[model samples]
Target: MFLITDEQLDALLYDLATLYGYDFSGYSRPMLHRRFNRMFRLKEFSGFEDFRRAISNKPELLNWLVAEITVPVTEMFRDPEFFKVLREMVLPAVANAPLIRIWHAGCSTGEEAYSMAILLKELDLLHKSILYATDINPEVLKKAAAGVYPQNILEKYAENYYAAGGNQSFNDYYTSSYDLVKLNEQLKKKIVFSTHNLVTDASFNHFNLIICRNVIIYFNQQLQNRVLNLFDASLEQQGYLALGTKETLQFTSVNQQYQKPFPKEKIWQKI
Candidate 1:
């Protein structure tokens, strides 16, 4: 196995950013190193230089690298309590609106977006809601738009749904076709999946609520603050912000601009 030196890693990140605009410079080095090393081994590269030459020869490899690096490990109703709070408390806060726009920032494979759709449908808000599910990976966005999942994962997701206060049979939301399950057409229609990089992209629309969970941990504090500020800007006054359980705004620049309504679940409201 070849060891990747710090200088080589820095050059790789710089080259990727400069040549393709896929910047990983703001990402945590240790995390990047781990992911880079994993890909290096998987690709059977002799060293960093070999990998760099390969990327130079086939530029599209950068897209695969981006997908691997930012690939999200997420599930439907990931933290059941988070979705529980969103249903029992958060949705009601915005339910009265004629048109409610919610942004699922860093949405991966459409699980959380579908979870939200289920919640909105149960609350009779689905028709009035327009959900935007964004991720940096176009491939993931394509899967999200399809709203399909492996059948093996549906059992776990069903449990999450029940725990998150699902009021109806979870099976009603999807139909199995061989090895995959497709989410309901109605629910799928409520969500629009698009590719948006939290690091480099500007906010395309204002939202009543923004849910960004478990995605920013790979970023350094500086990038986290930048993203938090972006969310703050993208949200309407007094709108809601939902983050992963481990994420916090207490130390970020936007900390004072939002208040925790469901602190345990990391749901904050803009002030």
Candidate 2:
């Protein structure tokens, strides 16, 4: 029950970033404090200093922290109307292309990636689509790459699927066994899940569409701007960018660079 002072938290974060090169400085202070506090209690660390020492000495603990902090709380088609707009408007525009590269930023446990794959398959573009599902947490990326989800969640996802204009039965995309639903191999093959640090790493590839939903909300304005710039650079000319319904680039420096394709859904087209 040791209280973490502001100075202690700052020193701990700075030391970790310097030693590990994973920058969490841009994350919101309150959010970071809460996450760290939870981890502290769970691990039984006596104080912030103790947690810092463990993180420095045991690099694996840092990975655990990263997973705990960066993992998105998401579900398939969490925003159904967004996917509907994507299918009706964005898909048609990109469908004619010979190939498409999509980056699903902050894709946790692969729900959004699978959702995208299912949508592309319905549109007969799955074969030509390469989805890069990126998250900073390697643990989550491993799970996402495996494409297995809890069986209990499938019913809800199925409802989301139908609501988002699914063309076929959602059951067709997964096989249920025991408590798990293994995503179809066909859908898994189209997606490449990888670990990516939006705060510290440079953009690696240009994508036709970048769906970074709800990830930036925990980031400070400076970090959000940095990530947005990375996304801008990573996107091709006239590419599409989709954000969470509650997020927007309207007041940001990059606001003028993208036009609103569907303001309600928060889909923007690169200008």
Candidate 3:
């Protein structure tokens, strides 16, 4: 395995920002080092210089490199209790929304967004809702937009679905062929998948709820604050914000501005 020195990592990060307009400098160095070293071996780079040059000289590789480095770790209906809260509490809180707008920030491959769609459809709010699922990596967004996933994971997702109060047959939501399944059209049409960088992108629109779970953990304090502020600005008054279970707003600038509805869950309402 090719190991990346601190200096080499710094230089590579600089080039990514300067040349490709991808700013990764605010990410935690230790996390970046781990991902970069792992990437080096996965891509079969002989040494630090080889890895650095491959990215610096060839811009097209940025998509895969970014996807690999960020590691879009997500699963359908992840953290069943959180989805249960969204179904039982959050969805009802916004039940009266005329045209529900939910932003799935850092929506890696979009299982959570599809999960939300199922929740909304179950509640008969799907017709008036729009879900914007976004991620920094376009490669992942493609899969999210496609609404396709491996068939083997369906069993796990089905367990989570019912745990989240699923009202219909879980199998009814998709069709399988050749070891993969595509989510039903009803779920796919409501979501608009696109590329968004939390590190630098500005808020594009206001939303009723912003679910950006488990994404900012890789960032340092400064970047975390910036992303939180962006989400704060993007949310409408009394809008909801949900983060990963292990993540919190307690130490951030916007902590005081939002009220945590459930003590156990990370869902918060803008006050």
Highest-lDDT candidate: 3
Q: Name model 3 segments beyond 4 Å from true.
A: 57-61
Clashes of each: 0, 0, 0
How does each model score on lDDT? 0.88, 0.87, 0.90
TM-score of 3: 0.95
Write model 2 residue lDDT over 219-259, tens digit each, in one string.
Answer: 99999999999999999888999988678997787999989
Residue lDDT tens for model 3, 123-237: 8899999999998888889889889899999999999998877768999999999999999998899999998889988999999999999888888999999999999999999
- TM-scores for the candidates: 0.95, 0.93, 0.95
**Residue runs of model 1 more than 4 Å from their true location after superposition:** none
Native-to-model Cα distance after best TM-score fit, residue 173 in candidate 3, in Å:
0.5
Q: Candidate 1's error at 205, in angstroms?
A: 1.6
| lDDT by residue (tens digit), candidate 1, 162-221 | 999997999999999999999999999989888888999998888999999888878899
Kindly indicate the candidate among 2 and 3 with the higher TM-score.
3
TM-score of 2: 0.93
